[model samples]
Target: MTLLTYLVPVVALLAQVAALPATSSAIHPRAPLAGQFAGDIGACPPLPMRTTVPTSVKDLRPDDFKAVMAIGDSITAAFAAEGMKLNPVENILENRGISFTMGGDKGAVTVANMLKRFSPKIVGASTGDRIVSLCSGRLCGIGGYFPQDRFNAALSGAKVENLDRELNYLIKTVKEDKTINYQKDWKFMSILIGANDMCDVCDGTNLDGDTYERLIRAAFEKVRINLPNTVINVMTIFKVSEIWPLTKNELQCKIKRALGLKALCGCAFVDGDTASGVAKRKVMDDYAAIWNQRLLKVVTEYRGKYDNFAVILDPAGGNTPLTQFDPSFVSNIDCFHPSERAHKYMARNLWNNLFLDSTNKAQKWPKDLDNTIYCPTATDRIQVA
Candidate 1:
């Protein structure tokens, strides 16, 4: 028999295996915890006192922001965020509406949705879909082509290297947006990137600590010079190397890896416990730590330098180890991306971080999926003085 004849039956068997449906309970857990909010804008309490408009960025409150923008990679893009559904294509769709940081989908517990509760006039939060085409590349689709992207300049597979493009797009979009008064309107921007860089460490990518710092500082400087009256929340990159042990044993994850479906992060997913694997993982961990330190340093340099621009370092995933989180928080599709439930959790975490002092922000991931959303008081400012 010809080799092609034998491969046809093997391919068919693999297709059948991939087609088998995953259990909803195992793949898409949705049971809310006791403290979880009902994903309602009405659930949020009103400010404790009368609203006083602030004239300075230092005095800006949550309600002061008139527009929102975000720049990052697939996490901000909300790639396959709905979890593993029946259709594999649907699994790869960018559910921008439900993204943890920038999604403005109605009834979704996202950072933008929570911000809306404070200021209904806030605009630019992304809504609807940005379908991704399957390709050999890590990220798919054009950046900012879809109207659904709105102020979310984030693109799939975006790294610190792509920050310049995303930033330029954001500046141009905000300038062209008729609803926004570019010079006067207070803008809130969130940035979460560098996972791809860390992931590519094993692949011989030249994204070391110094390069990461330089790229991030340049992005910040650009925003400082171009975007005024903006508060940038710079979230530290989490440790991707720590996630492998949690989901490595899952049958579906293993199957997907075998089929080459979940091969994005070589440092995290490739090579098990072999000597080379251990060495690569060590390198990844070291780079993650250095990158986070660089992020903090950049924030420190920019702090108090610009009156109209402020960069806050949000220690959400970076402060705590990923091993502390439940494995179920990961997406069922690739076993690396955050699930929708995790997105909600992240939204709460990011929202709460805005109200907290840098030193006081929650470091560890919430044990319960339904963690309490922090409500800001009249005295609370988004950027604490």
Candidate 2:
């Protein structure tokens, strides 16, 4: 009797879904997400805030920012596949009609590094360089992606201070190009750093929460003063603890070590399953939490003061969090830096936060988008405006 009762409801649910009309354009609307990367952009999420950085979604110019810049460690660096040859990743994006071009040496994972990941189809690159000369490795992917992405200004082994160093390089080049007036035109910036401070304890420079937050705060403040009208989006540094559990036991980590490879951030070295590794992992996770908390607090302050800054609280930041990503999100080579698709997710969140508000003001599409997200695709492909 119990099995039959359970089966009855399950069978009915399947039948109902099967009976639904086949139409991608007929999605039922739901409340917008809080600027996340989980769903299709067509499923409009809420905006970050009124004080966000983009001009307006309706400002659908093919090229949006005066310059779209990224900064960080290996996560942001561009490496050549052949260490001097043409990067297939860059070529693929260009071939897809995405308006992006590499300037510096090629990147290992071109799709994940720069502005091209999940940006609006109308996005553009400034006279800014494509790859930051500092990076030197394959880093990480993209599918179900929209064109018009951000550019890679990130360098390898970049700590918070390294970004402080690279700021001048990025700004000077863009300004020298004379593509847009620095004071008037908007520049897009993505800041994701601090992993080394937490995980790479090998450096032995264990900064307290105060010192770490100070460096981060100083970086943001400097950007505001240096780049007028710049839109700064800060992603909460990813949780190192989450990473340890994912790859520590997986065969990929072992293979990476066997091949004499190192993760961009060395996350594999901190195995939480073991006793000693767990201790270190706990401390690093603590550091990550403290940094994320400080980031949000600082962002709240900056948002009020600058009127062009916003913070995207990473779902991966805190304990037992809601935004759970699988190991595939990280690269297989080193398993530390995000995979290409992960970059797409990152871009999706940033894009959602930047444009969701404007999208809300626009028309709904696929009348039942959120509702039928799990529905079969063959039946629906219409775009409702």
Q: Give the alpha-carbon lDDT of every model.
A: 0.73, 0.43
Q: How far is 26's C-alpha from truth in model 2 (Å)?
A: 13
Instruction: List the RMSD of every prediction in angstroms.
Output: 7.2, 14.7
Cα lDDT of model 1 by residue, 1-385, tens digit: 1111222332343444501121122111232121223334456676543455577778877778889999888889888677766654465578899999899888787888888887888899999876752211333334335887889888777778888878888999999999989888889999998877777787777587788889999998888778888899989888888778778888988887676644567777778777877888889888888899989888988777767888998876886667766767788766787888888878877776676666666665555566666556666777543
TM-score, structure 2 vs. true: 0.60
lDDT of 2 by residue, 205-322 (tens): 5667787778888877777777776656556666655665666567856555444333333432633356766666667677777777787677667533444433323332233331
Error of model 2, residue 307, in angstroms: 4.9
Best by lDDT: 1
| Residue 238, model 1: Cα distance from true site in angstroms | 0.4
Enumerate residue pairs that collide in model 1: none
Q: Which portions of model 2 miss their true places by more than 4 Å? A: 1-64, 78-151, 258-272, 307-324, 356-385
> Which runs in model 1 stand beyond 4 Å of their true positions?
1-41, 48-52, 133-144
